[model samples]
Target chain A: MPLFDEKVKTQLVQLLSKLTNPITLHFFSQEIECPTCQTTHQFVEEIASLSDKISLHTYDLVKDSDIAKAFNIDKIPAIVVSDSKNTLKGVRFFGIPAGYEINSFIGACLEVSGAKEPLPQPIIDRIKKIAKPIHIQVFVTLT
Target chain B: MEITFNLPGLETIEQRTIPLDSSVIYDVIIIGGGPAALTAAVYCMRKGVKTGLITLDVGGQVAETSVVENYMGYNHIEGISLVQRFKEQVEQFEIGFLQGYKAIQLQDGTIKKVTCEDGNTYMAKAVIITTGKRWRRLNVPGESELTGKGVAYCAICDAPLFKDKDVMVVGGGNSAVEAAIDLAKLATSVTVVQLLPHLTADKVLQDELSKFNNVTIVYQHQLKAIHGTNSVEAVTLFDSRSQKERTLNVQGIFIEIGLVPNTELVKDVVALNHNGEIIIDCNCRTSRPGIFAAGDVTSVPYKQIIIAAGEGAKAALSACEYVLLKK
Candidate 1:
């Protein structure tokens, strides 16, 4: 059975049809000790099939050590979303993007596809002056 | 637990596009994603006012609720599901959304400025602060001393840490009862300490609490202090009716009495009541011109979802008129 129902799939198709650029979803997962790895991978694949502009690339965290390192993936069931030019915009999902997080995932994809920064111009200008690499980790719960 | 392929019905295929003009100032910027904030966004968007919504999470306190039956148009629905519907409706408009960011401060000026924790600032002609309330603390002794040690606010987040250990829940509202029910599944024993003479939650929740085997409900008892050396080991309670005090040996204490308004961001920028709730007029206008407040964060009489939504609409319409007048 499909993860998304026909109604949801149709809605996604219509939503993704307006994508101006293609988006790639890189999924990292491993089979051992990972409960939702397979399901998350399958969910991404199912979502990718809804629109031609969206593509899914699967990687085994254990076997594809080099690929995982390149993407800075440290955990299983991770997703890295990039724009049409394959440039990482620091958009990532650490676990299964189910529940309300799905909206954030899709919103990230649309933002990356459009190649537009959601921040206001003054904020973007201030961000451009950052001289050091500052990593921001936002802790969130599935609920 | 078995991994199921069930898709969460709380999600929608909603997508929003950011405006290409980076320098454009939105007519209104809403600082929440709950029923009130989303309703304001919808109303503002329909009025052709450029709106932006910034929130740490979409559902606010509603998402943490187990079930919602009081909201109109639905006999019963999960809190998260109802929030998803609100989100879907709001996404139909061309409003800018900055999710997963916490608004740290609000600066009042000719154009209001909202500074987020993500190091981004937003400008708007009108601002509506709907950031709802959060879990209220017991404010008893040892609560602040051992927050992470044992006293917790979120049962869902910390329940697994107390597996097989006895825990106590404070408060008699829906959140407290629901937390007791949820903790009973994992904890060795669950005791509920409520100050009221009777449980204030719905009869349905009260009925569900009665079915739990390892749950104890103590009424008319006030939580005087939390007791522990390194962690939460016990809690001291005062009996209001009997004029007696007692202590229950428990490893964890979950305080869910109620919530206090999330008005810190605007406390200095606008007028606030003694309870730290933003003060708003009949039109949802704050003392500061071009600023509005709504939802649980405001000094509203009721904190229901429908009431918040209605207030949000009013704030948005008022904001629209305010912006037009300035033009």
Candidate 2:
């Protein structure tokens, strides 16, 4: 059975039609150790199929340890979205982006495809003025 | 685990909004992302003012709601989908937009300064506050410690993890009853511990919940503690009438008592009511001359989407008047 119904698929197609640049989805998972790995793998594949600009790359957590480390992924069922510049921009999902999180997943894809609005010049200057590297983690939920 | 997808119909847009800048002093800067803020942005933009918006999330509590039926146009709509529409509407204008950043402080002056959590300060001639409410916590023992371990505030996200296990829901409002209904479908048994003698949720929700035989409603009961080491093991409930306490063994507990207004940043700046809601007059003007407030965060008689949107429009016009007069 397909994960997305026809109605949802049509909407997905319409939304993905707006993608301007290519986005790469790098999914890392273990074959057996990760409980939600299999489901999450299917989700990533299905999401990538929605847009021609989106491409998917599957990797085993154990086999691609170095790549996983570079992405700062320490857990299974993780997905990193690479931007148009072919660089990861901290767009990482730790688990299956199902339920309400699907909205975020779809939004991230569009953002990675250069569909995002730019930040202000002052905010950009503040970012450039940062002395040390900073890692920001976000948890998404309704409440 | 059961995976229920809340996939919304995707919306595509062009030239949505401009980036919010700190260098330019805005005419009006709204500090929220829910219905009120979104409506205010549209009104301000249409009124031909250089407007801006700052928020951590665009939807706020409205996004957390499962379904909404009260907002005029549609009989019923998914809360998130409605939020998406509101967002698209706001994006059509050239309003300065900022997301994933919260306004931490309000420095009241001729040119009010809105300090963000990112250590950046934004200035505006007039400000409209629409920061909505947040989920109220039980503040019981083990709740803060075992937030993700087992005690949860989001029932839709965490309900799947408690499959076939016992769980308890606190409160008697719409959110609590809705959480109980969701849990009863998956959990072995569902118990609702409401402080009131009767469930205060809408009649429809209460009726829907009653259809489930596995669910039990304990009226006038208060949660004392959530006992667990690593995960939730049990919870203590206190009965007001009996003046007794008892422990209910459960694997999970959902706290949905109610919501508290997000007025902490403006508590000292604005005149707040006893409940901490920002006090606003008929024009949505706060005690501060140039600062205005709307939505559930204000001392509005009723907290409804329609009400918030109307108040937001009024606030935008009032702020626009302020900016024009100041100039």
Best by lDDT: 2
Q: Model 2, B1-327: lDDT tens per residue? A: 666677643454454698789999999999999999999999999999999999988888778767889999989998888998899889889899888788999999999999997678999999999999988998888999999998999897689889999999998989899899999999999999999899999999999999999999998889999899999999999999999999999999999987899998899999999888999999999999999999999999888988999999999999999999988
Tens digit per residue, CA lDDT, model 1, B253-275: 99988889988788888999988
Error of 1 at B22 (Å): 7.6
Tens digit of lDDT per residue, candidate 1, span A79-114?
999976668898879877766566677778888889
Best by TM-score: 2
* Regions of model 1 farther than 4 Å from truth: A1-143, B1-14, B19-22, B140-150, B154-164, B181-187, B194-232, B236-247
For model 1 chain B, where is the 10-residue window of minimal lDDT?
Answer: B1-10
* DockQ of each model vs. true complex: 0.11, 0.30
Clashes of each: 0, 0
Poorest 10 consecutive residues of model 2 chain B by lDDT? B7-16
How many residue-pair clashes does candidate 2 contain? 0
**Model 1's CAPRI class?**
incorrect
User: Which candidate number maximizes DockQ?
Assistant: 2
